[model samples]
Target: MFSRAIAFIAAIGIVLTVNKPVISQNHSEHHSVPSPSETSAERESSRLTESHVNEGLTKLHQKNYSGAIESFGKAVEIQPSHYLAFTYRADIHRLLKNYQAAIDDYTKAIEFNPAHSYLRNSRGVSYAALGDYQNAIEDYTQAISIYPEEGAGYRHRGAAYYQLGENEKAMADLNSAISRNQKDAEAYTIRGEIYTNLKNPDLAIADYQQAAKLFLTQSNREGYTKAINLAKSLQQQSIVPDSK
Candidate 1:
């Protein structure tokens, strides 16, 4: 989820992040979710808007990030309240390292679709990247309150807590992340790092081992190797502490 949050819209860069899953707007529900279908026409106008979106996606796939943004911009301009275009454009901005712009577009997207937790989390991740952990924590807390079943929110909040050196709170949040999703490899990995910071190599190694196994199960070989290597390195450090 961090990768989803942090990884560019298409794996374009490396940094801290959360997952950015597409927000699912429930059309069948009676709730106040805004539907673009309501605003857009079925024949000519809808075709044009959809064409722009498709072109944007194609540009994104071609690694034409700026062009993709422009196309999404056109889509939104056609339907000023197009939620998907705003979200996609925001993602491109985030991937392009335009954090503030991404935040702005994410905000607009949220305006059009308020109940989507991933959108909130995506904005929080950008806020965190900009060194605004308090705001990020607020966003994460709100998302978690809205969707308690989601582990990504907990993982993000835990990481933000760790950033503020609130190790106890971070551990509690990390535990929640694991409880919500037993296969949360990043939570285990991060908790292991926290245990390392606490100077408890035994617990650290255990967590790292779990993360490695989970990553392997998730077919994330790179993550598995990194966690395993970290565990091995920690074991060596445990065997030979630094001279005081």
Candidate 2:
């Protein structure tokens, strides 16, 4: 069963669910198997776990999030300590808008693999969705500490900081993210929002325009909509009544 589970998880791509400002986390290259010296029972258990995980992945890809959760539950039942199962299950819960469930699953996954930066970053997103900015910041910080060069963690942390009214920190993080990933449309959009809040209409408009262009290149309707709205708002704000 364990062996089957391992195979299953590996057979299907792991689906990740990250909220706004993070897009998604993909760790397709992280799959690995235990040493060959492991007992046959262990291998079987791994196989079972993999099989269920694959089933869950299939459901997730089909957008049947509830069914995916059930499949992940089965995988977890077969191997309680299976970190990826917990992470994938958490992802499904997020997709279902079950924020608490997602947090719980992410917690379990974190306990099993504390060094998994992607899981930490994803969990931070779950916390952010719940309006727990402090927790979200902590998780993003931990992920940054683990993987300093990762732009996603910093961008997420920046978003959390912005929510917490820490404009300076947010700007710094957004700048860092933009430095790391020049083509990051989300980063530009987020930075534009921060600029708007700072009352810097010129900078905000520039950033929004860049974001809209990037979104157009990527065919992201949502980003384009946000950019258009920001641009319109900036334009209206610029046309102020003259004092006689």
Candidate 3:
């Protein structure tokens, strides 16, 4: 169920905004004008890469996943340093359950854009999907190091810790996540599971109730239904007479 909760979030695919590719001017070329032919080739490559990225986005929007991957692949082939192309391709691979392919693409993306915490998080998700919690935790840790103020990394790491049966570490990370963002429905849901495992039904039910409220607010009907049902189930159990 915790895996389902995480999967729900991942199901909402990440759509990276596209921008016109800008050709980076080389410092060495500043002193002397490039040959006209070289300049034309560079500009042409940029234009083609931009066109491919835009086409990829359109295909992605239309749910033409294979076409989207092809287009993104072309973009990256034209410009190997295009991190956005790598990222989009990685997302598609992840959705397709090609976890290893997704990790490979995400690694390429991270190489070109190391400062992006979301890239690390995305890679971690793929790693987690493969049941590699240790690698997932490492990626989440990097994401947290890059953006300590954000709650996503903490929430992700908490889930990974939970999977590894490190409940105390999970609790700490989940607490940090909730402290940073009280509206994080997934964090509350996960924390509720931890409470249930600890035999603290009162706290667990309370967390589930809160998660239901937040999930409703976020228009996550599935999550809201799950949380509310969990809360009600716990409530019913609490009132049940003990078997002598």
Candidate 4:
């Protein structure tokens, strides 16, 4: 489905950061607390959850997505308020095409850490996949506002604009992304598509050419084919102007 900007999607699509929760202890409270054994169990649970989170990171490195998901899920079960666990688990759900489940986990994570802009960006991607472009734009806009220097935020937002048939907005955002990140072949490719639709064959050819070169450099066979094929077609069309 996303055969065009595979690398681009991988860049801005996932939330992998683990947040360390702060637990403040109150020594002034005279009320009763948990028993010593109960405290031990709580400590054990926290330790085990940390272990699970570590194992999940290892599984992700090994490309065992399902195993990673299981580990993160276990961490969430051990501590439902574990924001990182929920965020990681939500990413797995998103990769597995479980959009609603991913949204739920992301929502829970956002509740725990509302200041993170990328969380909104990641959740926005899921919303876009489910044909919720409006929500995706909202999240992307928030992300842009939060981190104006982030090029990927603009890239994804441009794609969403293109999907919504807002070529002008899409092109503008893609231009911003490309100007900031020269190596962003995905942004070039997407902007090329926008140019093609806007009847700017010369600009499309330029973008597609750059996209193909970048994809080849990245060793992405699918992106190479997509860009090269479109570029060639556009080149041919440009060779023959329409008769007035």
Per-residue lDDT of candidate 1, residues 1-244 (tens digit): 2122222343554223343366233212322344566653544565677678768767776779889899989888887778878887887787777899989998999899887777878888889989999999998998887788888999999999999999999999999999988888999999999999999999999999999999999788999999999999998877796799
Order the numbered candidates by TM-score, best leading: 3, 2, 1, 4
Query: What are the TM-scores, per candidate, against the unseen true structure?
Result: 0.81, 0.83, 0.85, 0.79
Ranking by lDDT: 3, 1, 2, 4
User: Candidate 2: what lDDT?
Assistant: 0.78
Tens-digit lDDT track of model 4 for 77-167 = 9988887778767777887889988889889998887766667778888899999999899887877777677777788889999999999
* lDDT for position 47 in model 4: 74
**lDDT of each model, Cα atoms only?**
0.80, 0.78, 0.81, 0.76
Between candidates 3 and 4, the one scoring higher on TM-score is 3
Runs of candidate 4 with Cα error greater than 4 angstroms are 1-41, 241-244
The alpha-carbon lDDT assigned to residue 42 of candidate 2 equals: 83
Writing each residue's lDDT as its tens digit, candidate 3 over 1-244 gives: 2222123224445421111111122212322344566777787787788778768766776778899899989999999998877877888898889999999999999998898787888899899999999999999999889888888899999999999999999999999999988899999999999999999999999999999999999788999999999999999999999999
Error of 4 at 15 (Å): 8.0
Model 3 misplaced stretches (Cα beyond 4 Å) = 1-12, 15-38
RMSD of each candidate? 5.3, 5.0, 7.4, 8.1
The residue-level lDDT of candidate 2 at 11 comes to: 41
For model 1, the stretches where C-alpha displacement exceeds 4 angstroms are: 1-20, 23-43, 241-244
Compose the digit string of candidate 2's lDDT tens values, residues 1-244. 3333333333443323122211132323233467779898987887777778778767766667778889889989988987777877886677667888989999999898898677788788889999999999999999888877767777888999999899999999989878777777888999999999998999999999999999889787998989978988898879977779
Error of 3 at 86 (Å): 0.4
